[model samples]
Target: MGDHEVLASTGVSELSAPGRCSQGFGVPDLNAWFRVSVWSDQGGMEAIARIRESLTLSGEG
Candidate 1:
């Protein structure tokens, strides 16, 4: 969020489960906040998509 802008927001929520999480989201369970943003239409979404694709390739979401 340093140089980028918030193009969309879905707020935040809490998660509680009795088992391990594959996304590693449970490790930093304290930071329940979640967000994603664009970089002023300067290939922002593309960069994000690339990152998402990479994560997907590595078994992440």
Candidate 2:
């Protein structure tokens, strides 16, 4: 929310097995949330972290 008004939003819940999580963000006049689920039978948490690092978000409004 840099340079923009901050709106209210709920926080992300705890992540369990199967590499899944819910992420949320809020900005002036808007709010959004998303769920990320990464599946891999190997590499464990490191794999999830690596995959997550590659995720990106882009928008214009």
Candidate 3:
């Protein structure tokens, strides 16, 4: 918990769906997280990787 952190989760379901979550943290509580959902037949790690990349690019790791 070095000032800021990123949390993410990915899963599959009956259907494929793209989802994203964003949150702005306050000074006192610098925390951020996102979740992704996709079709059960699809790969979940890709979605999770995307989220991680986004966070890294945004410098919110």
Candidate 4:
């Protein structure tokens, strides 16, 4: 079996409310995710593209 390395990062940002705020409607915002892979050699640097998407409390994709 081979061992797998995993790395994770997170961040939060504040956004302005939409045109109008309803009784229960919340403000609009965004979340981002980035994945990267590092090597032990000096050959070169390699990185994966950044992934950004909307987020919810339920953790649904």
Candidate 5:
């Protein structure tokens, strides 16, 4: 399957909020990965930067 198709098949199986942190699950790129993270405005900005860096480094932005 294509990348978009692979991504589209993923779904959040569960969600949990613990204090200031939140986490969820899904198959990431057909790898069955569980994604988790803490919630914060500053963290969002940092994640943006990291994503940009990844795209630029991979020449996929």
Candidate 6:
């Protein structure tokens, strides 16, 4: 948390709103997380690198 944590999730763009949770697709099961080779290995680190590269290419993050 930061000094302004309470106001964190609010919309930065004027067109959006904070409280609008969508009727999204199917919820994932906890079991799916257990099956991934993430945090316990370099797979997690690689994921971050990939995301950074993607954001750099797309000009947003």
Tens digit of per-residue lDDT, candidate 6, span 1-61: 2121111121122225332221111113211111112242334535533433443111121
Clashing pairs in 6: none
For residues 1-61, could you state the per-residue lDDT of candidate 1 as single tens digits? 1222222233222135222121211113233334344443344445544544443111122
Best of the candidates, TM-score: 2
RMSD of each: 15.2, 6.5, 7.1, 16.8, 7.5, 17.9
| Residue 19 C-alpha lDDT in model 5 | 30
User: Model 4 TM-score?
Assistant: 0.20
Instruction: Name the TM-score of candidate 5.
Output: 0.28
For residues 1-61, write the lDDT of model 3, one tens digit per residue. 1434454433334232443322222232344334454443354556555645565323333
lDDT (C-alpha, whole model) for all candidates? 0.32, 0.43, 0.41, 0.26, 0.35, 0.26
Clashing pairs counted in every model: 0, 0, 0, 0, 0, 0
By lDDT: ranked, best first: 2, 3, 5, 1, 4, 6
lDDT of 2: 0.43
- Write candidate 4's Cα lDDT for 1-61 as tens digits: 3322232343212134222211111222224333333332321121211211222223223
RMSD of 5: 7.5
- In terms of lDDT, the poorest run of 10 residues in model 5 is 4-13
- TM-score-better candidate, 2 vs 4: 2
**Residue 53 of candidate 4: its Cα lDDT?**
27
lDDT of 2 by residue, 1-61 (tens): 1233433234233457534433333443445544443344454445545545565545554
* Candidate with best lDDT: 2
lDDT-better candidate, 1 vs 4 = 1
Candidate 4: what lDDT? 0.26
Off by over 4 Å in 1: 1-33, 56-61
**Candidate 3: lDDT over CA atoms?**
0.41
RMSD of 3: 7.1
Which ranges of candidate 3 are over 4 A from the true structure? 1-3, 9-34, 56-61
Candidate 2 C-alpha error for residue 55, in Å = 0.5
